[model samples]
Structures are given as C-alpha cells and as structure tokens.
Target: MELPIDHFRLLGVSPATDGQTVLRTLQQRLDRAPDQGFTHETLQARADLLRNSADLLSDDRHRTAYEAELTALSAEGEGGQSAIPALEIPNSKEVGGLLLLLEAGQAQEAFEKASRGLQPPQAPALGSSREADLALLAGLACQGAAEDYRQQRRYEAAARVLQQGLQLLQRMGQQPEQRRRLDLALEALLPYRVLDLLSRDLSASLERNEGLQLLEQLVRRRGGLEGESDAAFPASEFQPFFKQIRQFLTAQEQVDLFSRWAEAGSPLADFLASIALTASGFAQRKPERLQAAYGRLAGSGQAGVEPFLACQLLLLGQIEPAQALFEQGADPALRQWANEQGEEPLAGLCAYCRDWLEREVLPGFRDIEADPDLEAWFADRDVQAYVEQQDRKRARSAPLHPPEAAAGAGAGTPSTQSSLDAMPLWPGDPLASGLAAPSQPGQSGALSEPLQPEEDEDDWPDLALGWPNLHWQDLQLAERWAQLRTSAAELLAQPPSWVLPLAVAVTLGGVGVGGWLALRPKPERGQPIPVLPAPDGTVQTGAKPSPAATGAPKAAASPGAGAPGAPAPTPAPPAPRNLPLTVAKPSSAQLRSLLEAWLAAKAAVLAGATPEHPLEQLARSALVGNVESQRRENASRGESETVTAEVRDFSVTSQTPQRIEAEVTLRYSDARKDANGKLIASTPEGERRNTYVFARDGQTWHLAAFRASR
Candidate 1:
C-alpha cells in the first residue's frame, strides 16, 4: 500500500493559506510531474482546493477536526494510507450530458446525476500525491463556485455548491488562493439589507437624519458613498435603491455636486443626526446662520457627532418640536439608533435625566409617592403601534430587484455546467427574489427559469437545545398554555349544573369566614371563639358579632386569644382591669340577622351579582392569587409583560376603616431568539416578579405603591 502524504498534509494546517504560495507551488510541481495525461487545468484545480481548505479553517472547531485527521493519517502510515480512495472522471459523454442538463436550467437534476455518478477514491498516484491534488482541486472549484453564487444573491445555489465544496476540500490538502476567494465571496454576499429593512420598520418619530446616517454607513461599506461613481449601475436601474434611501433624507437634499477627493476611513459628510439637530435649531432659533450649520452637518460623515447636538436640544425640554426636526432629518443609520432607543438621538441624554430621577430626584420623594401617570405614559401602546405602522410603510415603498442573470447564452461561452466547473457564475441581484427573471435573447438559459423548493413548511430542522434555545422554549410553552386553557374551559363546562351546588355544599360545610362566633351554633363553655376557613379553597361561613352588637366604633378583642375550642396556653395575658358597664348585650334574633346579611353578601359577590360589600375584597384577593400563580408559570417559561406600578395615598372610612398607602407594580417578559440558535448574547434577563403593596387607610386597605423590575 502506498502512503498518502498529500491527504495527511492537507489535513495538517489551517484551511486558509497564502493564495500566491499555493498557486506557484502547484504550478512548479505540475511541471515536474510525469505526463500521465495530467493537464494544467488539473493543477489549477488542486490549487483551488488548498485555498478552499484554508478558508474553512477560519471556523475554530472545523480547523481542529481537520488537524486531528492529519495527525491520525500521519500516525497510521501505510495501514491508514490504504483507506485513502482514488477518484475517476466520468465518461466525456456523461459529463456532456450533465452539462447539457445544467444549460437547460435543470440545476437540481444535473447536480444529482453528477453527484451519484462521480468515481470513488483509488490508490494515490506517485504515493497518492496526484490523487490528493485532484481532490483538493475539485474542492477549491466547488468552494469558489459556491462563493460566487452567493455574491450573485443565489443563496440556495450558493449553499448547495458550498456543501459540495466543503466535502471536496476536506479530502484535498488546504490551498491558500482558494481560501482568499471564498472569503471575498462571503464578505461580498453578507446581507446588509437587514439593517435597511429593520430601520424602515422603526417609529416615525426617529430622526430622518439618524436613518440617513445609517444608510450612509451601509452605502459606504458597499463602496456606494457620495463622490464614488454611483454610476456603476445606471441611476435608472438603481432608482429603487435610491428611493428606499431617500425616506431618510429631508427635502433639503443637496443636488449641488461638490467634488471631494477620496481618503481613508469614514467618508466626511454631515451625519443625519446633525442634520436633524440643525433643522430643530432652525425651528427654534430661526437664525440666519442656520443654513451654514445645516450644510456643514449634512456634508460630514461623522455619525456620532449629531447625538451630542440632539442632547443639547433635549436638555431644553424642546422634546416635541426637536423630535419633529430629528424625524425629518436625513440619516437612516441615526434613525435606526434612535428607533432602537425609542426616541431621537438625545435618548441617551433623556436616559441620563431618568437615571437622575432614580438616583438623585427619587431619593427626595422616597416618603412621598411618585405619580403613577408618569410611568404609565411610557407604556402607551398606541404610540408603539403608530411607529410600527410608519416603519412598514417605508419598507413597502422600497424597490425589489431580481438576482443576476444566468450564464450560457450565445455570448460564445460554454454551457453553464462547464463554466461552473471552471469558474462558477452567480445569479445577479434579481435572482434574490426567488424568481429568476426570464433570460434575454443573448442571456444564458440557466438564468431564465424560477426554482420552487419542495420542502414542506412544516419541516423544521433539528437543532441543539442550548441557552439560546430558551426563547424558543418560551414560545412553545405559551402555545401549550393556550391549548391547556381551551381544554380547561371545555372541562369546566362539561359537568351538570346541579353538581356544582352539591360539591360547594360538601366542601364548605365546616369552613368559616368573618366573625367565627357566627359560625358557632351555641356558646361552648365560658369563652367565645371565631371559626377558621378550611385550608383547601372553598366556600365558608361568616364569623359572629360580639355581645355588644351596636356596630359603633369598638375595640375588637385580640383574635385567637383565650377563645373557646382553641389550643390551651400554659400562660395567660393580664386580666382585664375594667369591664364595660351597661354594655348593650346582643339578642339571638340580632345575631341571626347579622349572620344572614353576611351570608347574603358573600353569595352575591361570588355570583358576580353586585359589588361594594366586604365579601368583594375577599373575592378580589383570591383572583389576585390565581393570576399571580399564572404569571409565575409564564415567567418560568421565559415570557413576561412590561408593567409599571403606581402608588396612591387613600383614606377610606368604610369597612374596618384605616388610613394607609401602598405600592403597585406590574411586569411582563417576552420570548426572543436569534437568527441562528446561538445565544442571543445581546438580550438581558432579570427578575420577573411584580408586586403591589397596600397600607391601611382608615377602615380600608388601599393600594399605596406598585413596582416591577426586569
């Protein structure tokens, strides 16, 4: 068995290598190789493999595995070399047949046949170096094609070819040039459209200047900045791109062309944020010098500078008018930042003010309740909805373009399959529409047809459940909870009507509520006692009134103290010094009347017949408990709501009158996930509990304060 040094060596180093080094080395080696019919194309292909492998090494884990393979191959020596396979080319006719299929716009069929019919490995030629070189070359070609496809906006096609490329490159030794090409391709294709789309979806209140700033950055990265030849694609062809961006610009766009020499770093233009501030300043100062400031800011590419200006406006509390100017400012990037912050560029400044309130301002008011309305204003749903609607409107107006056209028309070029094998051609911008445009007379037929993937919508890929997957789990839990609610409602309604009455009677037979003395049929021995409700949730009897039943202001006896039927205490409290003289003793008939009134109130409240009774408080408290538990369940699964609590001071004289104040807090949590199942490292998580505390106000308990922190 011949040792496969090429295979072992390919797997030994990083996937990326210096492209020039790999290309020159392969050319020299190919020149010395025996003329067993190896062509220059074969050598070129092997060099591509090295480059492709080098690119793969960028991913740490893949690099590690590949390196390990090299170690294993080197250690196995001859025995391991036997495992190396040889590859054979298909018949010329078969290759031609596949090429024809590809030219006919049947990419899927051509790929399938080519993959199935390809030859397996054989013993290495010249210690298997030739075989290894061939494998590496094939890999590089596939990788290069994949990348090219991606650049042309043929994502699906790119993915397919890239998979093939990766497999091939794994077998071939790492080539340097191929890796560089792949990197370039990936960089070119990485979608910047997401920023544009997301920005357009933000609130209208965001300064146009902000949006313009963002668009400028995006355009600059793509080499589309001002003074750069915007002429690469005719203005007519790129009208949609310009239109999509124009929303961020105010009517004050400078049609006046001023030539500026290109230099390194960010392009100098007045950022959108500054433009917004200038507009706002003009609105306020209405000064003759406004134009110069506006012009200066609009031409500079410094995005960060405008926020400082916006902050100055915010500090003067010129919020609404300043916001209007900002909203109309020309900068998409600035707009995106403002949109995310839920305000204009001065949001950080405003936040500083809010922080002061919590850190500085609030300390002074610790004893006094903060106004609840202030917090509620921020949670206004209508404002959020309006902003979302504005964003959608902007996106709807953006232009949609098709990906690049296919190759293989009478341009004197070979069929698409051959070209692909040589240098992969990509679908242009138009192809991204998922509907490739019909080929023009001189265009390639492969670019003419549209593709419809066959996979079902219900088919979800398997994924590893990591911390990042928690958001998904939260969603799943919510769906489950909804289903559970439906089933529970159905079950609750299924029972016979009379059954509820019987069940309630049995469960509540011994339970007591209010005065315990009312529940007791007769006085037991010498002391009076109150009845306690059943531990299990159920209906209960009301407690009795004291012997002095006038209902005037009375100091109630300590509960559970020296009462009949209670656990005996070895020690007792000091005896009462003065018994009340001429106290109105309660009559049996009066006691019966009071008990009847209490029962009636409880019954009416539970039936939802009326309110404004003592029993209503008890009912509301129970409802709170139920809702609290549900919220806890939801929190565990990673769903929450944004809530704010308000504290109020109240003095209610009705029913057990007491003067008091309390706090109320509300909160919510929503599930979130990243595009990939990786940790959404950007999102922050915190406590999910919401609490409301009430203090006594005269005879009643009123909410004093509420709080929610996430």
Candidate 2:
C-alpha cells in the first residue's frame, strides 16, 4: 500500500546517509509537511519514512536487518514482485544495550553504537513502527558522547560532538522532539567552544569580536546581569574566558563592555569587570574610572562586589569607605587577586592603608574607651596597640634635651688669658686680695681714703700707718718726760760697763767664724758624674737628684764666694719632670679640620693611592685603627678595582673629652672587573651615614672605630 518507499529518497538523503543524516532528513520532511489537508499519499509517505528511518537509524542490528530486507526487496522488484513487508525494528533489548553503555559512562562505546545504528541502508526506502522512540534514543546517545568529552575538560572535542549532533538534528528538520533536545545540548556547549577559541588565540577572538559576543550571550542566557542564572554555570567555567581575553581589550573597550554588562544588572559581570579593572595596569594609573564601575556594582548590593570596590577605593586613597568595607571582612578572592596582579602601585596602596590603619585609625579607636564598638574594633588588632605602647615607651625613655643645653653642658667655657690672670697666686688666697692691694692714707693704692673723716679724727685715732697717734694729756706728758729724764740719768750711770764689750766680742767672733767658713775648702769634689742625654737631646752633667733634694730651699751666697778673677759655678737647672701623656678635648674648629683630613685620606685610599701618599701620611697621623683597616682593605682590592668616596655632610652625635661619635654622610662609587676580567662601569648613587668614633691623640683627633647606621 505504501508503494515501495525509498526512505532515503523520501527523506532527501543518500543510501549511505549516516544515522544523523537520516534522522535530520526525515525530520525536515515531516516539519515541512502540513499538519492538516495533506493528501493520503503524502501523509503516508511521511509516516512511512519516519517509521523506516527510525528503524534503520536507531540501532546497528535493526539497521543491518532492514538493509538486508531492502536488498531482497530490490531484488524482488527487478523480478516484478508485488509485495514488500513492513521494516522490522530491533527489539528493546538491542536498543537497551546502547542506553546501558551510555548509562554506565561508556560514552565512546555508546556513541559508536549509536553511530552504527543511525547509518543509512543500501536500499533508499525503509519503514519502522516506532520512529519517534528510536530518534529520541539516538539523540540521547549523541548527548552522552558530548557529555563525556565535557566532563574531561576536552571542551573542543565536546563542542565538535555537540556541533555534529546539531547539524544532524537540523538536517532532520521536522523532528521537533529530537531537534529540541539537540538544540539544548548545542546551546549548552556554545560557551565552552568560545572559551576554547579564546584560550587558543585570544587576539584573533578579540579582533573578530567573537569573545565579546559570546560573553554577551552568556550574560544574557544567565537571565541578564541581575539574574541568578549564572548559578547554573560554575564561576570557574567563565574564569578562563575572562582571564584569557583581559589583556587584549583596550581600556575604553573594557569600560564599554563592563558598562554594558553593568547596565544589564548582572552581578557576575560587575564582579568580573571589577577584577579586570584591578588587574589592569591602566586601572592602577587611572582609578577613577574603575571607581565608577565599582560604585555601580556595589550599589547593587552584590555579595562579592564590596571588597573589590574597597580595594579600589583604597588605591584611590579613599580610606574611610575602604576601611568600612574591609571591616565587614576581607574577601579571600580579592586578596588573591591583589597578590597575583603584580601591580606595585596597588600593592603599595594596600600597604599604605594597612600602615594608616595601624598608625592612625586603630590608635584612635583604642583611645576611645567609652565606646564599646571602638573598643571591640581595637581588640581585633590588639598587637598594634601593644606596639604603639612600646614605641611610646621608647620615646618617653629617651626624651631629647634641647640642643643648646646639651652642647652647653658638654662644652664648658673656653680657657682664656683673663681667666689665667684672675687665678689666685697661692692656694686659698682670696680673689679680691690678689686682684688689688690695700692703700695707705694719702697713698695711691686700691683703697687710699682714710677710714675716719677729718671732723671725726678726735673720736678715732689715725691708725692708717703702722703707728697710732697717742692722745696723752699735757700734764701726763710732762710727768712722763720728767720720769724719763730721771730714769735716763740712773741708766747712764749703771750701764755700758760689761754689756758693751760683750757685744763687741760677739760681733768679732761671728766675723771670724764667717771668714774661716768662707776660707775653708769646699767638700772634696766628687768625680765628675757622667752626663746623660735628655728626652729633648740636651746633656746634663749631674747626678739624678732625689725629689726632695731637687725641691729643697736655695741658700744665700757669701759676699766673697767668688774672687775678682774667678766666676761662681752655677748649678745645672733641675732636670725637667717627665709628664704623662694626656688626651685633649678638641675645639669645634679642630674637629672640623680632623674630619676634613680623615675624609681626604679615605678618598685617597679609595682612589688607589699608595700608603706613602701625603693623604695616607695624614691619615696615619690623625686616624688610628679605622685608617689602618681601610688601608689594608684598599691594598687587598688590587689595581683592577677603584673606589671613590665623597663626603657630603657630617654631624657630631656625641662627644667626650677623649673621643667624639660623629655621623658622616658619604657617597661612594665603585669600579671593578667582572669574573671574565671585563671592566664593568657601575655608579650606584646613594647616601650612607656612618657613625665614626674619633679618639683624641694629644691635640689631634683620630678615628678609632666606624660603623654604618640605618
């Protein structure tokens, strides 16, 4: 009744049509046919094609049986046979085998079986009773193969499988049920295909705008930016897509893309754009644009947008809002992004924020004891408070005195001639007595005026001179004179007898003794002592005297000690006392000179001068341990290397009478040979402050030790 139907011809496919081709061709024909008013022959042809095509395409065993049957029918047709039996589809058990393979995760095996089953037969016409069921089974097997590829992250292969299924379904145009399933599978795979293309060649995709279009489609399919449709696809799925294409997009393009997605109200789009903005070098240099995009996303109250926005705000120096966002809690994803982005300026900004919080905000919070919220906030970073307290303790412990006071205390008044002159002549002598002498009345001295006035003379005696004026009465004076005359008469009579002669004899004897002593030969002269040279090279012909003898009182010489023609021998001056070495505190000018000379000597050593050089001589004379160390270091460096040092400035940190601790800033340049002996020119410019301890050697200052400071 169906006329020897050629299923392939009816479905517009060749005899060798693959199973997918048969399914596609049959579906197309059915879809093209009207639902109503179709002639019986046309309807019958469509029905017969659906049945035979499903039978041939649904399973390999059924398709083989049908093909053999078709061959027999064809042979019968040549013989002019009138009958053609209905196509027999494989039993459920045969179809179940393919489904079992797919269900057991054996997708490749399932796909192979499905492919064989869908193969077109030699005869063009075939019919089956259960066409819809077989077609659906074939679609399921194709989806299974595609799913296997996807699970292995072989997106390209998965996409290929999905595309093949799509094309097959498209060709079988009228099979709505099978076509819909294939369409959904293909739609699901499109993003991965785009992602694969992007990963392979980002520049090509961007140039072609394929990546952008796919991203838009993905965003739209997720029910616009605002919708939660993205929950269906893992964030990891789109991560590769964004990461691959981020560098290729220009700033404006990124902004436009982000702005469009943001307008679509998709939180995922906003979040991704925020990440891209943070990752971009341009965004680091220009944060305001990023801020606007972030502001829009954050306004939407998205779960992840706040922290990213906070980071951007931090980079922009917007501390308050950034702090608020961070206080809510740090986002691990954003922190990871910040680290991997490798944007130094952004990293620096984060460090600045951390420092600011620790140094400024946290302290303010800690200081507010009355506010529980502030206290609780401070408690989170209590270590910071402890550090602050320690720092404050250090500051308090080493309170800085005024510079003037410290200098004044260290440097007493300078010795002067006036001060020497003002000293007392003897120990415990009063200063006023040594400075000025008391004068007699009517004499020119420090105090020449009389003690009493002329009018007060009668009240007080004139005792200015050694003797005082006697105020005896006239009668008393006469009585005393008469008594004195009487006494003188008595004395004149009794005296001058033995006493005068005794006095004369004693004077004569003293003169005789003196004459004898003077005439006596001096003690036998000892052998002339050998002379020894003084430290200063002066010879002294005398025995080394005891300290007491050398300090003994000198005697007065006799009148005739030396005869007219002979000269008196003079004792050699006592040998000068040996004084111990003492350290002398240098003045400001002397310190400057010492520092300048030390610097010059260092420069000389660095410049490759020999130890015999003038600067080296000066260094040896002025600097001790440090100079020798430097000289040794320089000598060890050999001739191929050269170092030059320039003193910038210096300050005295501390000073003692014996040593000075000074901080000196110096700029050094070094030139040396590499491992291959090739001369490498390198000039590293920076300031170094070294603390040098200078010990005073006599009147000169010598560098004793030196160390670098922070």
Candidate 3:
C-alpha cells in the first residue's frame, strides 16, 4: 500500500496548527482542486485528512487522546519496547498504568492505580532529575483524581488528594518546573480546602494551622506579598482567604506577623499592619507607626488607597490634612469609605472632588482657551475707542422709547410731550375738540400752571345765616304757624264742598271722643285672665311657658338632641363612629431593634448555640417561620459563623392594621470559620437594601417576608 500521508502534512499545516488555521488550509486546498476528474484513492485521502484534522484540532479531549494514540503507535512501530524507559520509582508499572487510565477518563481506576504507585517504598539513591519526573507524574495523577472528586462536589476528598500529592512532591524535592505546576494546582485547590475545613468541625486546631500554612505557601509561590512573580495569584481571588486567616489571630499576633511581613517589604504588609495597629489600639498610642503604614499605602499609587489613608487620618484627628486629601483625591472608593465612617462632610468633599475632576478638569483640558490679558487689551486706546464706537452705534440705532427707557425714565429729564394735533384720538371723545384746538400762548401757560385753592371768607360765613339769642323758641313757633296758614289756604283753594264739612265733623268727633273718654272711669287692679281648654284636653295659654314651669327638656340636657320649639330641632348630629385603627408604622428605632435581634440570632446560630439559648429566644421573638426555622437548623449543624447587621435607615412604604411594608438599608457581614477557630470565608462588608413585610403578632411586629435588592 502507498505510504499514508499525515493529515497535518497533507493539509500543509504543522501538527500544532489550531482549528481556524486547519479550516483555512482545508478551504484553500478545496478551492484549488478541479471540479471534475479525480482518482478514488485521492478523494478518499482528502476526505480522511479533512475529518482527522478537524477531530484533532477542534476539541481538547479528542486532541489529547489522538496525540497519546499517535505516540503509542509511533513507539510500537519503532519496536516492541519504548524509546524512553520508565524511571525506577515506587511501583513504576502502576505509575504508567495511572497515566494511561487518566488519559482514558477512567478516573476511579486512575486514582486506584496512583494510590498503588504511591504505596511502594522509595529508592535510596534516585537521581534528582529522575526523582522530580516521578514526582511530577505522581502529582498529575493525583490532580486527575482530585478533579474527579471535585466534579462530584466531594471537596474534602479533593483536598485530601491534593494534600497527599503535595506532600509526596515535597518529600521528593520537586524540580522548579514541577513545583510551579504543583503550586498552581494547589492554588486552585486551596479555596476548596478552606471551604471543606469550614464545613467540618476542625477549625480551631492544628488542621486550621495547616490550611493556613498551605495558603501562605500558595501566596509565597506567587511571589509573596510584593507580587513580584508574573504568575502571582490574583489578590481578588485570595483576599477573602487572607482576611479569614487574619480573623482567627489575635490583635497582638496579627501585629507581630504584620510587623515581620512589613519589615520584609511585602506589598500588602502596610495595610495588614494598619489593621493590626488599629485593632490593638496602637494607632492611638503609637500613631507614628500608623502614619508610616498609611504613608506606604499612599505611595503605592494604587486606586482607593488614598481614601483609606485619608479616612484613617481623619479618625486620628488630623482634620486639615484629611480634608486636603479628600479635596484632592477623586476616587469613588473614598466616598464609599467616608459613608461607612459616617463622616458626612468628608463624603461631601469627596463627591465635590469627583464632580470637579469630571466636570471641570476633564472638560477644561479638552477645551482649553489661550490666556489673553483682557484687562490690558481693554486698557489700549484703540480697543477702548472701538468698544465706545460700538456702544454709541447701538444706542443710536435703538428706538426713541427703548425697552430700558421705562425703567430709567425717572432718573433723567422728562420727555417733551407730543402735540395733540399730531397724536391719534378716539372718535367722539369729549376732550377730542378741546385737545384739537390750538392753544393761545397765555392759555397754554395757564394750563401748565398748578391750580391754587380759593381763600375762605370768614366775615361772610360768621353772621349771614346766624340766629340771634332773642326768643328762638317763639320764632320757631311763629314760623310753624305761618307755614300752617299757607298750607290751609292752598287746601281750601282746591277743596270740594264735602272737605270742609268732613274736617269740621272729624274735629267735633275728636273733641266729643276726648270728652267722653275723659268722663269714662278706668278699670283697676287684680283681674284674672282666663285660660282656654283645647280639644286635646290640655290648657292653652297665649304666652309660652318657661322651661322650668313646663318641665320641657333643655337643649343642653342631652347631647345631640334639640329642645322643643327649637328651629326644626336641628338634625341630630351624625352618630360618633370610631375611626379605622391606624397601626403605627415601624420607626427607625424599631427597625434597628429588629436588625440587632436578627443579627444576634444569626450570630447565635453560627456560634452553634442551642435552640434554647437566650440569643435564640431573642431571635425567635424578633423573627418567625422560615427565618426562625433556618436559624434552628444552622445552630443544630454547629456552623461556626457570625453575622452582624446594622440598620442605616428605613422607610415605611405602606401600613395596614395587620401588617406593614418597609424598605430597610442594612450593612451586613457574615464570617465563617472551621471548628479549629480558623476563619475560612467571610462576606465582604457591604450595604444591602431589603423590602420587608412585617406582620403584627399581637403587639409585636414579626418579620413575615423580605426581598433583598441592590
């Protein structure tokens, strides 16, 4: 048979060519091929190469398997024996078998084979390079096994396998390359280890110390705190673990460790030292060290570091310097830190700084103007003359009654009035003719002058109509008689014949009646007025009876009832009804209390306190249903964790007789540790707002439902 062409060579690409390169090469070959006439064998070869190239380059698993198969085939074709003999280490056959098993995805078999390989005794004088290769193979096997465990969420098992592999490599004194690979593997595995430990009951003991040491090793392998290695672990990925470890150490121990690390010039050492110093109260006693630590952080030129340093400075009572720093730095982190510190002025200053930098500095730089001396330019005679000419032109071009004329009219001379002949007038106005007439010179002058009041004549008003003191009553009577005579004469002139007779008769009748009434005797004294009986058999009197005599009900006798004969007995006032009970909305004090109670309960649960513990009781009193049940379950599990919630503010959005709705902002933190007292995980401190529905159980408000939001 003709020698089979390698797919890579046929495709005109290297064996290591990527999928895209392979596809591109295949496309080129297809495009160049003839449309018709080709041999069957050639077509078959092309198809085979295309398929094999795609398979080898597309998927990692497939590629790895193919490569291994190719290696095995090459070895077999060369001879019945391999070119490179396996090293004489613990169970070398098992080591080879483990590699084969791992490549085939037989992880269980691989783990069993690796375990068997690790069981044998080591040779006394293995070469260093050979030993390192063996150790490297063993680590790969263990890593495969650990990955298998991890896929099943068996974290503890994974950690155990990794730990065993690390120990083996350490004993063998792994080569630099081998050690780097193993360190990377361990770095990936550390988080799982921490979680496993925290989930178990081995936190406060030697296992915690071991785990911490493992973390330190990983940290050191990544170029220690200075972060000098390109392969250094990401701070974001490992910062929580570092914080956790520090949480387990006392302030003094932390200070000692931080001091040592700082002396060694670790990058994060200053930050750690600051925390330790603050916790140990050394910030107040030996502020110089604090200052040095902050100085180092500030010098790092890292984002957000300045804000923290400024906050610390402010706390230490260095107000002026802190203020200056806040006004200078434009970091958003500063605002957050200031808010957390409850320094409103500092926060405001940081906000101002951010605004200034964004709105003024950035835009000003983008649109900068040349700085010309405006005052000096204006002082030049030509420029001044030009400006004056423009002003005069504008003034002259303006209307006689400019818009500003009304405002400044009183400040200058009055404008001359236009002649009435030249002004428009409405038709039929009474003053139209008067205004239209041409004025005489004297008349115009007289019209312009203000009028003067006429002088009063006291002599004429003193006696013209004044009456003398001589018999004023008699004079009045005589005047009345004269008026009566005049009236009588006028009446007689128009009177009919009956008028005089009727008048004489009326006069005589009046005289006769007066004489008769004068002669009649007047009835005197003490006669009784009669009372009539009505059809209803009640006595009726013309005058109304007094309230006391009649025994009638008074208006004030009964509330909202009217007295008899009162105007329509004003409709009785509407019946008094109780208003809907207004359940008092939860106040900040109440929300804060609830927050404290909840935090206390969560802390108790994390501390592994029994359900009957006082803290649990307090928690139960504050919480209900699922929340309470969850606490109990956590407590039963003996979880070593603590949570604290601080309520910053709350608003009651709605309320009813039985329930209330409120939005609460709380800063929350949850810390977890292993049974050996080594912290493994903790939530970063942050503010969260939750809408809570509180149900009223009797008089106390209990949390019913809550939705956490941004």
After superposition on all C-alphas, the RMSD of every candidate to the true structure, in Å, is 32.4, 42.8, 43.2
Candidate lDDT values, in order: 0.32, 0.42, 0.42
**Candidate 2, residues 1-710: lDDT per residue as tens digits?**
12223444434566677777677666665565544232344345445546565566656787677678778977997898865544232333334334334444556655555555555751112344233333444566677788888888877687677666666556544346656776777777767765565445434645337656776787677665333467656545444444444434444455567667756654444544544453332212333444454455455454423444554454433344454565443444224322321223233224323322222121211012121121222223332233233222222222122223334533442221111132222223433122232332322112332231112233434433422112222233344234323322322221111000000011111132122112222212111111111111111234543212221111111122232453333322333211111237554444444544555545455454543224322322323333454456645754344444444456676665654666665554455554456776554433345555555445544544344443
For model 3, the superposed segments whose C-alpha errors exceed 4 Å read 1-143, 152-156, 162-203, 226-258, 279-310, 317-710
State residue 135's C-alpha deviation in candidate 3, in Å: 12
lDDT tens per residue, model 3, 1-710: 11133334434677688878777777776555432233343344445545555656667787677667667868886986654322122232333333333444555455444444444564324654334334555666677777888888777687777777777667766545545665676667766675554334443556655655554565566665545363444655454455444434445545565566656666455455554554333212444444444554555344433444554453333344556555455344333322321123543333332222122111211112222121222234443333233222222222123223334556453342212111111124323222323332322111222111122223224422331211332343244334323322332122111000000011111132122112112212111111211111111245643322221111111122222443332222232221111235555445445544554544454455542224322222323233445456655655466655555556777665544566665555556665577877675544456665555545545544444432
RMSD of 1: 32.4
Candidate 1, residues 1-710: lDDT per residue as tens digits? Answer: 12112321432332355445445544554354323243454445444444444454545676567667756755676664544422222342333333323333344444444444434544244334444444434444455456455556565466556556544444443444554565455433333332233234435435334444444554555454333444444434333454344333332332111111122322322332233333333333322223334334434433333333332333322244234444544255334323322222344234322322222121211012232121232233442233223222221222111122223233553333211011101123342223434543543223223433232223423312212332433343344334323322332211111000010111111221111112112311112221221111222235433211211111111212232453332232233222111113322222222222322343233223452335323222333343345345535655432211111111211111211111111111123233343333221221122222232322333222222211
Q: Which residue pairs overlap in candidate 3's backbone?
A: 202-676, 203-674, 203-675, 203-676, 203-677, 204-675, 204-676, 204-677, 205-676
Give the TM-scores of the predictions, in the order they appear.
Answer: 0.21, 0.27, 0.27
Lowest summed lDDT across 10 adjacent residues in model 1 is found at 497-506
- Top-down TM-score ranking: 2, 3, 1
Error of 2 at 192 (Å): 4.1
Give lDDT: candidate 2, residue 319.
Answer: 40
